[model samples]
Target: MPADADIRERLEAKAFELGFDQFGITEAATSEQIVAGFRKFVELKRYASMEWMAERIHQREHPQNLWPEAKSVIMLAVNYGPKDDPRLLLDKKDRANISVYARGKDYHDLVKKRLKAFARWIVPEFNCDLKVFVDTAPVPEKPLAAAAGLGWQGKHTNMVSPEFGSWVFLGAIYTDMELPADNPHRDQCGSCSACIAACPTDAFPQPYELDAARCISYLTIEHKGPIPEEFRKPMGNRIYGCDDCLAACPWNKFAQASSEAAFHARVELNAPELGDLVGLDDKSFREVFSGSPIKRIGRDRFVRNVLYAIGNSANKAYLPQVRTLLADDAEEVVDAAQWALEELS
Candidate 1:
């Protein structure tokens, strides 16, 4: 017999047992509007240097392209809400403001572990084929989560759970099990534009669109080249990623800090000093961010980000560190060091 609504109830209970905070199910299909919006986003080159996005556009727009036999998608969310507002650290220009999500253990590792466990539990009972994914796949996780009733894509283009606000990490399990789908969540942003106004780089060209080229998170985390002159000052002390839009959501007022201990902020990364980070040679950088997502950017890119923050700090105490990195092997790091010196001058 195929899985039914009863299976969904059991699965949801099991998801909670496995440490997921929110759960929903949706058909293994993509929304046409989301597909169009994504196409337009790439067509206009809003994805910036994220060429991988263009590479997998077809698979991303239609999840079925990834696995033709999958009949349902189990969307799960883990709340990683901070105990305090993440925006507060921005004022301390000498402190590096890592994104709230990156401060904790990498969610990819945490969420994928749960996803694999859930897939294992379901496969034996239902005899259904399944595949688990975190962020590695070309999955349209946010849109799929919205389709599964986890939340609606907010104006900032991140899924905003009414319960968790904008602080959820999404993971997916694609399965052939024929489970009932939930009602899709409708956009509830109302008239609030707090998220848009809070962006330091004016990344939003419109209420629901993001020009990733100007987005601090993308620039810090994804872009490999020199910091654009226009955005360097606005980059502030954000060394890894930016959370200004997420922090400004009024819905977050009702959000609670994550119950999952794995999501709690690590002390060293919580509000690191820019001076401390600017001096990270490749060896020290690896040790400092061993298991964190920030490590993926490597020492050159990581220190490059730190140098920009150093320039923004106006602390001059960082001058010696900046001057030392001026001779670094990586051109990106050397370029950032030069920029920092000019900014300080």
Candidate 2:
């Protein structure tokens, strides 16, 4: 085998042994087509309150601009699919639906730890400088993954692996090694608009573009203030992150349940009762979330999410539970609780 072919084979083997679901490598280069489109998207203010999207436009599009010496990027994805349909909880108005991703351990810590190990192995064998990044960095993981032949970027703006569907968590390792690049995947979305039509808030302004401010995922997890009234009712029982777009993809029928034990959903988080979640105080909340990603949102944001779920519940029995939180301190939490009480009452 040629040197490039040999390196690719070894890298694939190493990635599998390290617990990654899939791996691909690509040369560090920019696509002006993608950049131009991204620029137009930003100018339209589709990113809404996500100022960070506009702040790093240059670095996000051009990988070399992020780290000058980086010659190649190895993109890795870990699958986190669950056993049953995530949409089932939507029917139970009294139950809150947590996104499948946050139902398990935080992918940041898990993916980063594995990427660091992969980096240590790569540098010793290839003698290259490297940096690893999960979602926290400025690196454009979805675009890079598509460039590496992992999968096409679906209309929903997330990486869709042919093997793992849309349930993969992406991570990247930028290195000085000039490894052979894989062929980029072609756009496979074609005429399908399942995800586009399924969005409750119509967060997608156009195909492949998302307005995060209107997205339930951003509202419940990232936004700090009261959720706009327009989105609050549509948010339904989704307490953190929304999966309707991802779940609507027809390709998801090929998605397999994740093999990693740590990524499996904890029973407590699976269709949790709104009243039960609203009653959790800080200490109890910490204990419940413990090693899960939900803890990072902290107690206040979490209760705020639960309050939204309570309002959506339309269950008058939950009124007392929602009322109890109104006088409790955090402004965001108290505000949401008060709104929920009125809605329920």
Best by TM-score: 1
lDDT of 1 by residue, 1-345 (tens): 644767888999999999999999999999789899989999999999999898889989987899998889999999999999988998999898999999988899999999988988998878889999998999999999999999999999998999988999999999887789999999999999999999999999999899999999999999987978899999888888899999899899779999887778899998987887888788998998988999899999998988988898888878888899888999999999999999997
Q: Worst ten-residue run, lDDT, model 2?
A: 29-38
State in Å the error of residue 78, model 1.
0.2
Q: lDDT per model, in order?
A: 0.91, 0.88
lDDT of 2: 0.88
For residues 1-345, write the lDDT of model 2, one tens digit per residue: 349899999999999999998899999876887788779878988777778888998888888989999999999999998788788889899888999998888888899999999989988888779999999867888888999999989999988888878899999999988999999988888999999998999999888888888888888888887788788889899999999999888888899999987888888888887878888889999999998888888899988888888888888998777777878889988888888888877
Q: Which has the greatest lDDT?
A: 1
Q: Could you tell me which residue pairs clash in candidate 2?
A: none
Candidate 1 clashing pairs?
none
**TM-scores, one per candidate:** 0.98, 0.97
Where does candidate 1 stray beyond 4 Å? none
Q: Which segments of model 2 are wrong by more than 4 Å?
A: none
Residue 75 displacement (Å), model 2: 1.0
